[model samples]
Target: MLLPQALKKGDTIGIITPSSPAPVLFKARYERGLSQLERMGFKIKEGKCSKQTQSYRSASIQERSEEINDFIHDQEVRGIISTIGGMNSNSLLPYLDYAHLKKHPKVIMGYSDVTALLLGIYAKTGLTTFYGPAVVPSFGEYPEMLPKGKEYFEDVIQLRKKAPYVLDVPQEWTEEMLDWNTQDRQKQMVKNTGWKSLREGSATGKLIGGNLNTMSGFMSSAFFPDLEGVILFLEDSFKDIATQERSLSMLKISGVFDKIAGLIIGKHEHFNHLNAPFSIEDLLFEIMGETNIPILTNVDIGHTFPSHVFPIGIKVKLDANQGTIEFLENSVSE
Candidate 1:
């Protein structure tokens, strides 16, 4: 995988609204995130799509693609992050300047709907993008960004910590929902049970996957990375077991489960089971149908508070029995 340089003080992060016009939707929080980024010793370059909005998305596909390509072409921008993720990021794929991005090779990070871009870029350029935080929902949290989230972000992008390191499971976490514009108090914190080994075993491979639901839009495209041997991690927000069944089946039909070296299931943020007769795990096992590979569930990674940043396409060891994942190398170069 192509590694981008580590983020440093004074590094300029280009902010683009690839999907949702979060900057306009939540102006105060958007500015708060920018202020926080500046406080962290980085300069912010707000993109053309940042302040623009058109209901569900920031702009048309051409405009969004232009906004991102502009940043990719900018020599001053050290990194690129989405202001937030939404439904239409998949629409910008064909128009992306992958050849330019491959030559430029800068850090690109975001989650949820931005999965399309993260994995697409990685597949196109072999650049390691991040399944991490975004502006409005992460750094823009009321009062302040969650310390653990900030630490993980810096630890991965800024090299605040070294590798061969085991990710520390947070003592507590929350999926409590609050209106972004009206949030006042911090989210309700609940004790984290940590990772669970649904099946006992271990395997090491390049880490791959993001929001499972988002993957549906682009998984069949050439932009999607080959999951021939991956520690496949997946997560979602507000999805019910039925939707999960469909998505998991999508993976199954694609032969992902059969080819993957291991599996890591992230904690679902506000999962609605719809009072199903089966658990998510049960459904997963049913869909998987007698796979012998190592499997870990409820690993704290995506769409959840204090989530660890997983560098897409980086080497990782998945120890299902120990319920741990250890990074084998630093994701960013010096």
Candidate 2:
């Protein structure tokens, strides 16, 4: 994976809406997020489609694609961040110019629906992208980002050589209502449960995986990377365990599990079960039983609040025994 240069204090981070438009009703929160970035010592450049809206889409596919393409090729922009993830990022895929993106690889960060773009870029151009917080959701929230989220972003942007082996989740996890217009509530802290191991062992491989549903769309596409010797990290939200099992079955049938070195299951907060009696764990163990690789679940880097920023397409070592994931290469250029 090609690591882009680390963003500096005054680096210009471009914000684009490659998916849904910046929520029209949440303009204040969007501004608050930009302010947070400024406070963190970064400059901001708004994309042409940042505020554009068209029938539930951010902008026309051509417009969104051009905005992203322009940002990546612009030498002045140090890094690129999505305002937020939404449906239909795949619509921009056909319009992306892979050759141009390959020539000017930069830090592209976001998760959820943006998984399509991130994974597509990685598979096509070998450019490492981040499955991290978005400007609106993480930086623009009423209470600001959780400490772990902030730490993870700093580590990724600074390209830290040796990040501490900590997977601390915030304790005071809240979905309560608060004023989004005020900075006074931006300092509240939350509690988190640390990491957990599902299978007892150790393994090393490149990190790969993203939003399960988003990934499902890429199942047979050229964008799905070769899963050989990879630690498959997956997570999802709003799906039942049965659907999750079906997706897992798809991966299994696609031979994804056969070539992987290990598995890292991210958070699946709202995964429900229908008539199926088996739990997610039971399903996972049943499907992955033949692989015998290290399996760790609930690592807190997925469709969840206060998540970590993970670099896709980077070589990482997953030590299940120690319950940690260590980067095998520099994630950002010095």
Candidate 3:
């Protein structure tokens, strides 16, 4: 696997709007995210799609791909991050300069709908991509980026913390929804209940996965990574039990459950049980049947506050019984 170079203090981080027109729609919060990066001692270069908008997305499909390709061709840009995630990132896959990215590997990070790109890039070029925070939703939190979230980002991207270490379960977290435009206070955080071990076992394998709903968009395409011995991690936001069943069933029918060595489920933000008699866990087990594997859930990842940065293609050990994840290799080269 190819590991991008660790970011340095003065590195230039290019920002792209792969899907959402977040920079245009949420100008103040967008600027705040950029400011956070600048304050962290990095230079920010806004991509072409940064200011463009086409109602739901930042730009047309071709324009969005062009924005990413431009960044890929720029030697000055050490990393690329999305302003936010939306619905059509998959449209840019066929047009991306994956070969160029393979040769000039750099850190590409984002979560939610950006999962399409993260998994696609990794699958096509064998270069690690991050399933982590995005600009408007994460780094641009009111007042400032959540301290723990910032720490986790730095730990992986900047190599401030090395591998062979277990990720910390945050002491507190929040899925509180506030009006991003009119919000004037920090989110209300609750005490973390910590990760839950659904199945007892341990497995070490390559790390891979992102937003579950987004995976369905391109799962049948060649861009999707092979799950053969991966410790897959999945998360979603604002989804109900019914949707969760369908998403899980997609994996089951595809033989995904049989291929993975372990599973790490991120905390689902605003999950609606819909008055169901059974929880998602019960549904998962029902679909899984006798296919036993190590399973851990409710860990800090995805849309939740203070989420951990997961590097796709890195080797990781998941101890489900203990509810711990330990990275076996550095996510980036020094």
> Which numbered prediction scores highest in lDDT against the true structure?
3
Look at candidate 1 and tell me the lDDT of residue 71.
94
Superior by lDDT: candidate 2 or candidate 3: 3
Ranked candidates (lDDT, high to low): 3, 1, 2
Q: Candidate 2: worst 10 consecutive residues by lDDT?
A: 168-177
For 1-334, candidate 3 gives per-residue lDDT tens digits of 9999999899999999999899998899999999999999999999999988888988899989999999999999999999899898999999999999999999999999999999999999999999888889988999999999999999999999998999999999999999889999999999999999999999999999999999999997999999999999999999999999999999999999999999999999999999999989999999998988999999999999999999999999999988899999999999
lDDT of 2 by residue, 186-290 (tens): 543345566678887888778888888888766678876778898888988778977888889888888888899989988675666776877788898897667
Instruction: Name the lDDT value of residue 323 in candidate 2.
Output: 80
Candidate 1 overall Cα lDDT vs. reference?
0.91
Sort the predicted structures by TM-score, highest score first.
Answer: 3, 1, 2
- Model 3: which ten-residue window has the lowest total lDDT? 50-59
lDDT of each: 0.91, 0.80, 0.95
In terms of lDDT, the poorest run of 10 residues in model 1 is: 297-306
Q: In model 2, what is the error at residue 129, expressed in angstroms? A: 0.9
Which regions of candidate 1 are displaced past 4 Å?
A: none
Question: RMSD for each model, in Å, please?
Answer: 0.8, 2.7, 0.6
Model 3: residues >4 Å from true position, as ranges? none
